[model samples]
Target: MPHKLSEIISWPEQREKAKTYFDSYGWPDNRNEAWKYTSLAHLKEGKFTASSDSAPIDSAQVIDSAAQLEGFYVEISGSAVQLPPQDALPNGISITDITADDNARAAAFTHLADNHLLPALSAMHQTSAIAIDIEKTDSAAPLPAVILNLTGSNKEGACYPFVIVRVHKGAEARIAEIHSSHAGLSCPLMVYEVADDAKLQHIRLQAEASYTTHLGLNQMQMGKNSQINSFAISMGGALSRLETHSLFLGSDAELAQSAIYLGRDRQHHDITSFVAHEIRDCASRQLIRGVLDDKARGVFQGKVRVAPDAQKTDGQQMSRALLLSRDAEADAKPELEIFADDVVCSHGATVGELDENLMFYLKSRGIAEEDARNMLIDAFLVDTLDEIEDPDFAAFMTSQINRWSLARR
Candidate 1:
């Protein structure tokens, strides 16, 4: 892993700009509205160095796991590895190191320049960056999925990896990013650009070790008539925070986002998102669900903003959490900032425990207590999982939920 100041100096202009921003507003504290529920005390206390330690990983096992997924797979073990040659990939798709092309590097820097603290830190210390581009083709067949796997080492240092994805006009694609790690800190950044008339299905899975700390940022921009559907599953890490920021850059764009998080033991999970409607007739919807047990904590903070000129915009957001134990905690904040008079926007949040009556009913039907509890938990989250369009991916997520529930019992 590279040091922040050293990595920033590698790019002079970005270094100066990032230095100014850091000096002005340092790391966010509890007073910051966006980070009130999440504290960086643990991260600041650790002595995090940058090192690419591959000895902890079994390359053969990583390859075997990627083979089970449906897509063109690229594995990043502290650095980019197991990337297929361009000739091996499909005609319309290309995945390459961002530093290989000067233009792409510049574009990535520009895209990341205006982001907040975590993203800025990721841009400054990123050890490697990947760029995925999909071009519009004459073929009628849907493009295959592209999977990016990020794995961290056993060291107590921070790992920085960045990804940029571009879907050309009139093209359609699917992407899955999986993050699995050991005892360390991980900060990942990603940017997605969907062109006019294009469609993208993006999925992210975070299943790091219980001793790891993870912070991630995802930024998206949608063009006219573009559609983006995103699904995220968070089930691991001692303390994890995932933030998403989306902008509708043109009229008639649409975005749908769904997320499920499971936290147990003394773990903490935070999911925060901000969606901006910058143009007229754009639509956005979000649903987030969390299950926490055994003194765990879960937090959801979501906000939707519509510009004054963005008339006819439609936006909705909902967050719900289930606490399985008396000591568990759940916090939710849903907000809407609408400046357009003709826009339709709404936000709601609910935090509660499982329905005891329903659990008793299941138990009366000959189900064991643990089984009954798991059944009710599944029923609570099935609606959101059903929102996924891909049946295979949905089934995988369901299995993960089942596994977590079984362990909790």
Candidate 2:
């Protein structure tokens, strides 16, 4: 019965040694190394409770029913957590709502909940919270719209959560981490930290509910000429996993990793990223894309590491997949490990489908073979909305990917 959130929280022995190594290595059934390819033993054999002690949800109607990531400034509707004071943020900003007075934000949420596991299962089920701090200012604006609303509460196993974000030192920010799931078993976690010569732009949007289960973990620290541009977009979930861990730690640091996952039916989407350059002349770039239909299942794992003084390190990794059925399932793994030697690492992966001569040349231009396969699935999700260099957040993520490909055609 050891599951009242691992028996009343007293962890902090590095999360009780990673929850006693996942309780004697249980939940990774398809062989470890990041659960091989999505298997949490069917969500721990479904005894999945703990998500609804109800009440306290109305961050202005969950930011007016979510799905709006145009410009940010904290507007969550359900599980209520909204803000705008501090002379209405934005000039050398700092916004805190760490679940309001949890004994004065409980030491900044126990310094990111002491060795995380879904942010210590969302601070032992505290529900809604926010702590975004961004310093450094010498001009330039247009980077402030931190809206996080993980809605849920249609009651079936209700886990709607939040996290810790801090971006300081020579800071420049652009964040829009949005998620909306109004139907059961939903889980949400977001943790971010980017300091030193900082310039961060992270936009992760997962439009939820398909028997939702989203687990997101993003932790980054890159000093020196620091810069990070991360973008993740998963159109809906059933079992979505986004785990990104990065560390470059000073010296010409920079990273631009992108993602896009679109799944249908038995949806299971996974996008994993791990980038560690350690030090000295660092630069990294990773691109990931996926789209699976019908018997849906997609996973992309990317790893790029160049330590050993990371001399002149320049790393690149790519993953591409598009299977439109034939019992859809696509997996791509890109890896690169360079122990310096004046590093210049590379990685590649691809899985094919669609493009039957560009769908018979867009059905000979008459365009009605399901409208030329929904305009080639909206031009393959428009290269993840042009990596969102913010033209109004890439035209609102291209109108939410053409309204989720016209609601999956």
Candidate 3:
């Protein structure tokens, strides 16, 4: 097999740094706050080698095999990406593995690296970094759409992939990023920037094979007066974890986040988030839900920070989980660190099984016991999907949920 990324122009300089970072730190143990629920012993013990450069992937084949998505499409494999020209860009915007060569891209890249784990991802992987620039407009046109496709074959070893996005000022866009791999352990990192007065709606989906091991990081920056609404769904992979961190740099900015996880068999899923309110009049909300069956495990950790001067800040968070089997496990930790006395902040977490009364009610309506149970689970999760502001985006999220539910049933 080919041994190194052929497209990376700066590989020789970054190789030593990559090895140093991975070896300097131990693979996460159970004691780490971010990794308390999910363990990486299996990934670390398997003795998997880093991925060797593989052949180019077929974009059409990936799209055809994927669940249908309504938006512009781009695929990222290794450090290679294919994008349409700016003028020819579709009303629904989309691009793959892009870089920051100018000021606009730099703003987003720096924001992501400073606040999140993008620096580690950048130094380790040979994947592409994508930057999206949205133009500002007064009237709400149909939300421009963007989709990112992640694909790789790890039959030989493990691989690390990274992608980046930047939303320009006064622009509006909606994006969906999907991660898929066939034969190896894949760790992908993504970072985003929302400029001043801009609006961004984002959706993330993880549907990899059962043998796949996955790690993901999503970091975002919300500029002054900008709005960011985001959601994520996790259904496949032996182990999948997502980390999100967002900071409000401008006053009057709003940030909303929601996620759903369904894990069966021995699958493990983890979602960790941190939202920082730094300026006055900033507001944020987070709601997360999960369903676990068989021997599956689900994890959620949400933390909110309010600066001393961030008066009038409104922050609320909740996490609810359903455990369907005796062996299943759900762990949630919602934390709040505040320095401002004038702010309003609250957080709560819950773990429970289906309501027997609701199940009995559905059965009384002549619904089969199994169908009634499935219906209740669906109802519980719809709230997270309802947060999507655009109707078209909502439909896509609904389809993803339904697809996972049917498979579990």
Candidate 4:
């Protein structure tokens, strides 16, 4: 396991800019309004040990489930990228390690957020990056999903990995990213680009060890007539934050973002989003659900901005949390900034304990007390899962939720 930063790095300009920005802000704290609800005071003295491509990993287990789903797969252990054979991958799909290509790295960086603190932190520590490209257009047949399994050593250090995904004009793609490791910290930065008339289905699974701190940044840009549906599950890590910044470049695009976060045993989870809808006739929706128990804390913060030119835009946001224990806490903030008069926009949040009436109803139907509690919990989370259009993807998320519930029992 390497614990030292690489002497030679790629994309120097981006790294220098990130370093400069991070130095100004340092480790994010409550003072930063964005980091108000979630604190990083515990990691103030922490240092990032960039993972190397020479690091060893168990190749067999990382992406077996993804492969079973007949999906294309990529595995990143440390900085080592294991790609499927070109011959095995479906047509119109390609994966490349772009660390050596300055132009490619610059192009990818241009499509992502530069001022955000998390991305700056991620950019400063990364020595390499990868990109996945989809080229098919006007196809009647559906494309195979792409899955990325990112893992790090079970050591007391951090790993920084950056990835870019591109869906070309009129193309459609489904992507799943999984983080499963025991490293003290994992920071994965991702940027997605959807061209005109393109579509993207993005799913994220953060299941790192309970001792790990997973901080991630995801930025996306959509062109005219494009659409993106995104879902995320956070059931691991001692402290985790998933922040997203989505920008609309043209009119007639849509975005649907939803997530479910589960925490217990002093864990802390934060899910944040900032969406910019500056084009007309576009729409954006946000839905977040959280379950907290045993002194755990969950936070959701989402903001939407509609410009004056963004007429006929529809934006909606809702965040709800169910606390299973009195010690647990939930915090939610949903905001909408609209300069457009003809747009429909709304935001709401609700945090509460499980319904005793519902529990009693299930118990009266001959269900055990513990079983009835579980039932209500599942029912509360099912609505989030129901929004998913793919049955297989929904089932995969259900398994993770069930595992979390089982552990609580």
RMSD of each: 4.9, 21.5, 6.3, 5.8
Candidate 2 C-alpha lDDT tens digits along 183-209 = 455556665667777888777778765
Worst 10 residues of 4 by lDDT: 49-58
Per-model clash counts, in order, read 2, 10, 4, 0
Q: Residues 1-409, candidate 4, lDDT per residue (tens digit)? A: 0011123334677778788887887887888888999888767857432221112223243345445555877888767888888888778899998867777776677755655677677767774588999987456878888888888875677778888999999899889988886677888889899999999988898877667778888888899999999999987777888988888888999999899998887888999888888789999988999999888899999989888999999999999999999999999988788899999998899999988899889888999998898888888987788777766677777776776676678
Q: Summarize candidate 1's per-residue lDDT along 338-388 as a digit string, tens digits.
A: 888998888899999988899889999999998888888888888788777
Q: Whole-model Cα lDDT per candidate? A: 0.78, 0.68, 0.72, 0.81
Q: Pick the candidate with the highest TM-score.
A: 4
In model 3, the runs with Cα more than 4 Å from the true position are 1-21, 46-67, 85-87, 90-109, 113-118, 137-140
Against the hidden reference, what TM-scores do the models get? 0.91, 0.32, 0.86, 0.91
In model 2, residue pairs whose N, Cα or C atoms come closer than 3 Å (at least 3 residues apart or on different chains), thus clashing, are 57-79, 59-77, 59-80, 61-77, 62-77, 62-78, 63-76, 63-77, 72-145, 73-145
Range of the 10 consecutive residues with the lowest summed lDDT in candidate 3: 1-10
Better of 3 and 4 by lDDT: 4
Ranking by TM-score: 4, 1, 3, 2
